[model samples]
Target chain A: MFFRRTRSIPEEYLQNIGAHDDLLRALFVMTQFDGRTVLDGVDLAIRRGEIFVILGPSGCGKTTLLHHMAGMLPPTMGSIQIDGKDIYGIPPAELDELRTHMGFSFQHGALLNSMSVLDNICLPLREATQLPEMLIRDIGRIKLDMVGLIHAQDLEPSDLSGGMRKRAAIARAIAMDPDLVFFDEPSAGLDPITAAEIDNLILKLKTVFGITMVVVTHDIPSAFTIADHMILLLDGQQLAKGSPEEILSSKDPRVVNFIGRTMPLADPAKVDILNYVAGVDSRLPEPRGANS
Target chain B: MSPSATESVAILMPSRFDRETVPALLQEVRRGIHEGQHRICLDLREVESFDSAGMALVVGALRAAREAGLQIEIQGVQDSVYDFFSLVSVERLLEEPQALPRPGFIEGLGGLALPLAEGSQKGAILIGRSMWGWVLSPFRGQKLRLGKIAEEIFQAGNGAMFIVALIGFLLGLILAMQAWVQLKIFGADIFVADMVAVGVTREIGPLMTGVLVAARSGSSIAARLGTMVINEEVDALEQMGIHPNRYLVAPKVLGLAMATPCLTLVFCTMAILGGWLFGVTTVGLDAMAYIEQTHQALRTADILAAVIKGATFGALIAAVACSLGLGVRGGPEGVGRATTRAVVTSIFLIILVDAFFVLFVKLGA
Candidate 1:
């Protein structure tokens, strides 16, 4: 459950840490699937009222980390403290109370296809509050307006375009004016314009509401645009944690390769296509003839 | 106690602190806090009933008081209210209470009973709504898809006709042949017709048809709906605010209900024909005399009972199938399990229902 800090904490990141108290703190958080570890000894401190984006390649446990942070999945080791309360250690009722102030936007809209856009937005409000239909409808309308989905309120999730569905899901996520919001791959599978629009919406929501946002994505452009602070994960390990500028300038080879989109070079002497294909030894063999 | 300069007067809590009373009570308590009361005490001795809304109200007031740099205390708390607060872990606001003991075997049984009761309740609602869907369709401008129902009827009943006829014919022949050997010893071979007609019409015809349909159509229905559930189409329907029972189940129930009795009639007629064939060819009895004996043994009530049983079994099979299908989870494996469960449950219910009908008939007689 011990994580070795890979690099010195960036001065700006340290300043950001000093600026606001941590709303979410993960201490030695680890997750295992079957026998293999998915997230290994991860430590993170997400400050309040800031956009914290988790950047990772596929299978790097970005979504898993997000789920752990959101209390949807329990870590194999360590603890996640949300607002100084141990998320998993609390009783169900207390956990529900904590969750009431939080919202999660899934990667795929996950909007109930049977419900109209309006009802999808209204669902959480209706479930969590005893407010009358009229008030609930007004609130739903406001959220739809925020997401620019007022014209499509009467249509089903299936009837809307993919970007519209994502917006609708975002509308539903923010419907309760939650203190914390988590978005999983908001810009994934979206066109660049739609993706930028989603990124802008994320920024606007954070700016206007002053709510903390945690976005998990591999979309590098989207991450750079929206993140005030970011964590780069590789093989379930934190490779770097800092602002986008610091991350871009990181001397770490992995960070440089990832940010620069550089492919790892392979030496001809170390080539073993057959072994690699068989998954027997994926690592490059030692140089056999190096100018000898 | 009277209000003093340093000691605040405790507000008397209501006996019933539920949704109806809590709103007004919360407002009054908030007003009291706003009126320069730094120390507030709530008298909870009178509380006979308390719900989550009540707890929320009290918690909200406490939070507001704390935010305003005031203090609040609870006094004379009733045991029941105290227990509820402890159960909900709200005792963190006060002092932590001892953890309650885990439930034992009997409690586990009671826990199991809840879901069973809930499932039965949901089944009843499904049945009621499906029935109403048929009854009110015309007025509601919702057309019952006769084409879909017809397809189901054909698949469940008409396609089943060949097997029903084959089994019915074989049963009649076997019954008459078995009875002929004994009757021949006493020179009463004419009674073979009587035995076969009564046995097939009263029991075997309806029972065999039900079991066949249960295996054939019931499993199919469960598999179809279970796949739909896996595909999230059922969820889609639910999201659209349409009841799966009314949309998916009602047509099948009505179609099978109509078709079953007709199949039962065909089964009984074929069985009698088979007996006549056996009596004339093998027993050396007069064909006309055998037909007359079979006719004499057959009662109008017996045919009516068989038809009623057929209709009831049909409805039960469809309902059981639909319920199991709707409850399916996981994936293809779940659909397979649901299909197996539907067949087994339908057959069990068919036998159980048939036995009840038999008991009623006997009592009436």
Candidate 2:
């Protein structure tokens, strides 16, 4: 009710990457949490390796939609098909086969804190492949280096900062070199400097490896900056989705209100694009001169 | 939507944020800083409030953005949230000069940790996680969590120590007192020491300790394992095609088996000591005679019986814990219920198994 924008017809629906842009699909899928619908009769498709951000306010179900894509959360009434294969109908064994091609970066970085950065990064390869330990280490090292964490290999995860933990998680996500990587709030709890580094890493993973990513996050700028395609979910249905630029420019009040509030609050009228930071106002003075 | 957020989280913040909402808003702020943009404005119009939770996010974001040398601004907050923020007045505390100071700890840890997890812990942790993966994973799938000899031993043996010691002490005292009361009528009260020594070392000491451990530690294992199973940690493993049980379950069982016996030996000592102190010094039995009778009754077979019971009980406990953990329900509450059930079930099963051991040693075998 607080977000009372009239539902305008989203313009991207016509050229919307809804069908042709679909790399995966679900038919009438539902998930129940305590007889309450966490996800109810949701139908949607996600494209491959495209950094597709799932955006929503808290309780809007951004994360739930992402889990469906990763097969982490199964729908109660519907089927999700990955690469055209119905996930529910497929045996559990087959689902695993599909997962080797997919990677997940959890909100906590899900790095096994019990493990070292290298071990967390190469976990997938060791679990799935018989590649020698040396080989796993080599690959893990490469990815850690990719995340700029090559120096942190032997250290336990407990020692890393919020940004480093995420980078470590990214290393783990890309270790198997899966075609698709799912990032659940890749930028949460990080400083802007570190968060941007992670965002750039997301873009690099896609650009360099051609990996498809489905990110679940409330960070509007990170979503707009990193995502090629996007989907907005509310009450277990797709509210709207399109390219980042399109989603941003659209007059759909729902879209406008969602982005407008979350975007760094500045005088929209006086705010100069060149002068504005994505989440902060440029009006705040530099600290160096004052401190001096 | 991601269950990890609702259920768990991505690379869970290494540690929980001191305040929850701050991190969410901080993330938004970080997004701005990363782009190296000069000015950023965050409108809290829809947010409707700026209490600790809301302000935490805004201030947290501003702090990070400032540290990154980006200008920060807040606009359009409702009365309630803004009032709460002012009430706390912590916003001014968070507001400061630009740029965050990089801590040596963060750089040091991630710098080294990422490599090792990617290297050594992969196989071991995967094996450990997989044991109960099938029963617990959100989607039906293959996975592995438990495996490795040392790990199994630790899970089984170490985790159950507290329960074992507690049971051992209580059982020892109970056995001595009960034996004394019944024997007094026959002028056999002096035999309480012998009875306690033989009974404890020969069976009760080892067996009871293990069963106790099974109940306490086993159930704990089950709950922890169960949650991991349903939460997709197990599925994540299986998707990687690692065997779940051999890695996850094997280690726990073996760990318990190895540790429970050692613990049982300690329990035996304590139970006998408790009985001796009470029966001889307090109950008026001749110390020398009691010691001799106890020695005579405590034969090699008795020791074997106790050790065997301890090992068996340990194995049972580990198996139950691992199985329950793996078979836990889907949600957090479900995982909790499974943990509670695992303990109750494991304890009961341990006692039942102990009874079978007693029967077999005495007659059936």
Candidate 3:
């Protein structure tokens, strides 16, 4: 006999992103865990059928922002609206219904290790639809084929390689044909060629299915390749929000530094192995004959 | 007038060709193909809406036509279905299905049996190695860490002291009350003291302690080790050439083995005290006289048996918990399952071992 009060949307939330054609929006979202702020005053809107990339370096709030927008985490302040509805303000049943139109691809794939790849893809469809088993299986197979993982349909998630697991996760995300898909580091842990292929696949999904994607990534090249609009985050703050070209040409020193940094070349003259070892073991006792 | 016209046939698709209608429509299409309609034309101009199932049927039909040396064509497809088809290529369906390798009967049976057999063998090995480490640790130059063993003892024994005392006291009171009814009829009401002391020391005290300890300490041991395995701390120890049996399992086994006997003694004392309380208040027996009778009735062998039973059950609990925790698979979910299995298995083995002692003592008597 437990009762909970239904949350109502604030008037300010309605004035912010309610009038836009945005399929997803975050209005001043802030998150704190154990008194440590992970996301601070983040605001953005994802247009319907556009690929919006959340670009950031490691340890920034890119994934945290994605989790908030996906309704997996409640922010400390502000609201997330999906389909023009404040997701947090709705009741549990309404939130669940809203979640049906959204899909999230975890960075680690997060496929249930006990189930096969095909079962993982079919999970949402089987739970939500009244379709026959054969039809569900057919749809599952089609999703697997779309990700080029049909050959691995029967294999467990533990059996898949990193790249294959990512592909399978993507297949599961798109299994319900959701309107909004969140991809967390889609090209991460993939080889250069495989990463490029994933980028191309993202583009293809956007163009053919018109599924709106919000990709969170630290990879500069991958972001530029697939992003229609993007926001760069640094230390839980949005540094820049614009197209890829705009991000590249951004006058902000942090954004420029993040995009412009490259691998430092090693100089042969400065490569002294003995000196390096000596520096590492400075506290070690001198060898018996070293002083002599 | 052309000779090819005899082999060709045309069929109109339903307007709402979806999962519900696809089956009937599919049956008709299959009948046409089965009846040797060589060139089939599926006219979808009338089909306004269709879903993925309908798309799958079309692709399946195209694949079937190619395989059967027949020609199939679809004309005037709608925009939405066309968009879906473009996303999931028809060429994918035309490609041959990959051969999924499935295990045969014998292989499947082996898959089920092998892990159980392996786990049993590993459990035996763990028990053997832990026993050896405990036996040989004193002789080795590196002394066992008394601090860690002492900490475990404090947690497992002292932490469980209150619940054990409460159950012991309640049990003693109930036993005396029940025994008073039968003994008073025979004018042997004084015998209640003897019965309470003997029963508590011989069976109830050790048995209850075993159940309580297994419920409390055994689960914690399993959960800790399982999380350690998940976090790769167990692997880290192995990488550093430190044996897990010596470092992790031995201390717990020794601590619980040492602490359980002390707890059993406490349980026996509390039960005797509870029986005295009931004797003085309800039975109207002289408290000092009841105490003397109880003292005389309890023998050394019975007390030894209780201590031995408590120690054995404690060691068994630690061993079972350690084995299941170290052998965990999957992830956090696997850790939870392992913890449950550890508690159940420990209690089961404890009772089994207690039964063995009961038989041994009866035969000796």
Candidate 4:
């Protein structure tokens, strides 16, 4: 539990951010075991009113990248900034203030089953803010209502289906109307209908609050549909960066294989087919869409 | 003057520092610079994110890089992080970190099964929680310690009552029938009444019923509660500021304490009735004759002794059940094991307690 993600008011976020803002310049970066850096040298600008998505393959470390951005994880190198101040530059009082406005959704929703959905949603506020019960309930009701989960507020998280739990978790994450939000693999466990629903909810939040968003997912379709800006990572380094279209058109073989629009010689059977059946040499195919 | 606030500026930001990210990135940088870790690679590998602390660290790193004549490389930068570098001038200044060799494909194969490498961390939590409960005596208050008297009654007495009554009645019948068979072999059939009445009221009724109650209820309480303990729900409560001992164990102990003695009395009554039924039917002894002999045979001490035994056994059974329950290990299987231990221990303890009660009453107290 101690190694888990943290959020606080601007003051607290600032406090935790103390003295660290001077050094950091990377967002959600991880080093490779072999000392060859992956998620290579990614730099991003997530505006206050934008949907920024890091779209990549299963091993591209998009989730790791998201964690870096959200402050759930510490980067080996680099800094994240909020407002004019580097996220870690602010004083403790200011940092705590910042954590209050940022909402993070874990991949599994991670709702506490012992708590009712409403109470689960209310946890961050209870931990961080001294808002009155009535105020908290009102906020919870509003968030749940916005997500169409008002009726399910009293139910335990286990009682709800997978999709409903995400909505409830989202409601909880946004219980404070955070200015910035980070979501991890929102569509991973959900069916198409539910995945689409979560996507739509994400878009709705973006549009309504004009809040900054950083989303991480392997769901290519959802990522393309929702990302205002998308970046791809390969082997812990940024494989490609730009729009969803930019990623699709990447000549990088790793990028081509990941987005699934292009064929790459990953399956051993595919290589055999090319050499024997297609009358081609045993070699990796050149990417068709780099700089397109 | 400062290139107009809106214009993006290139600040020579620190690249790799330590494991932390964001504002703390700069903090580490500052500390390093203060500690003179110049020419540092603000390694982007481990960094997750940062707030102001990261920014400060970056600034400190940059400043250190400049002062120490040490070069800084902010390599492995994610796109979102690039914005910070540019704003701070590191985008224009810092170079990328050096790349080392990659593992060969064969060596890399070991890192596979990430497909199967699902983190089983969730299970560890459940085990840690129960073990913590077992180690920490959370089940202690003035009147409500884990092995304390009140705790035992709720766990043992109430849970085992119905089973005790049923077993006691069956024991009475079996004892009566056994006596009746032998008595009928001779012309002393009427004396079967005396045998059963004395047997049930004095010995078999109290002792057998308590043992049966211990077996039926004690094990069950241990298993059910032990499973709860092992599952980490108890630890979760402690984390949430609710003391598990007070919230979970106290009430159960209190409930069992109140329930066991009453159940024992019921068990004794049922057994006496069972004995009377067997005596009248099998031996052809008139009910009045059986009643008169039983009255002649029975002593107030016997009744007192049995009731007293019931009370003591009830408490003992409860204490043992709770003690076992509180000792639960993680997982469903651990619960089953605890249940078995609770029943065996309760039965053994009940017999031992019964011996002492009878001896003490007969001898002096």
Candidate maximizing TM-score? 3
Q: Which lDDT tens digits does candidate 1 get at residues A1-292?
A: 1222223334463344322468987777788889898998787888889999999998999999999889888788767778777688788788888897899999988888657788999998789887555446655655676677777877767677879989999988887778899999998999978887888888877765677999999987678678888999999999998887667656787876675552223523213422332345656433221111
TM-scores of chain B, in order: 0.66, 0.55, 0.76, 0.52
Query: lDDT order of candidates, best first?
Result: 3, 1, 2, 4
What level of docking quality does candidate 4 show? incorrect
TM-score of each: 0.48, 0.45, 0.79, 0.42
For A1-292, candidate 4 gives per-residue lDDT tens digits of 2232133224553455324422222443343435655555566656557788877668767777776666565455555666545555456677667778888888878887557787888787668765544445544555666677766777777578878877887877777667788888888879977887788878877755556788888876678668877777666667777765566546676665565542246755335423432335534333221112
Q: Write the per-residue lDDT of candidate 2 for residues A1-292, one digit (tens) a residue.
A: 1111123223363234246556776555666677887776566677766777888877776677678778776665666667666565667787889888788888887777556788887788778875545445555655666677777887777577778888888778777767788898999888877887788777766755567788888877677667777877667666676776556556566766666677664634324321333334545222111111
Please compute DockQ, using alpha carbons, for every candidate against the native two-chain complex. 0.04, 0.01, 0.26, 0.02
Residue clash pairs of candidate 1? A114-B239, A114-B240, A115-B239
Candidate 4 DockQ vs. native: 0.02
Worst 10 residues of 3 chain A by lDDT: A283-292
Worst 10 residues of 1 chain A by lDDT: A283-292
Candidate 3's docking class is acceptable
By TM-score, is 2 or 3 better?
3
Per-residue CA lDDT of model 1 for B222-279, tens digit only, reads 8999999978999999899776777899988988887888888888888888888999
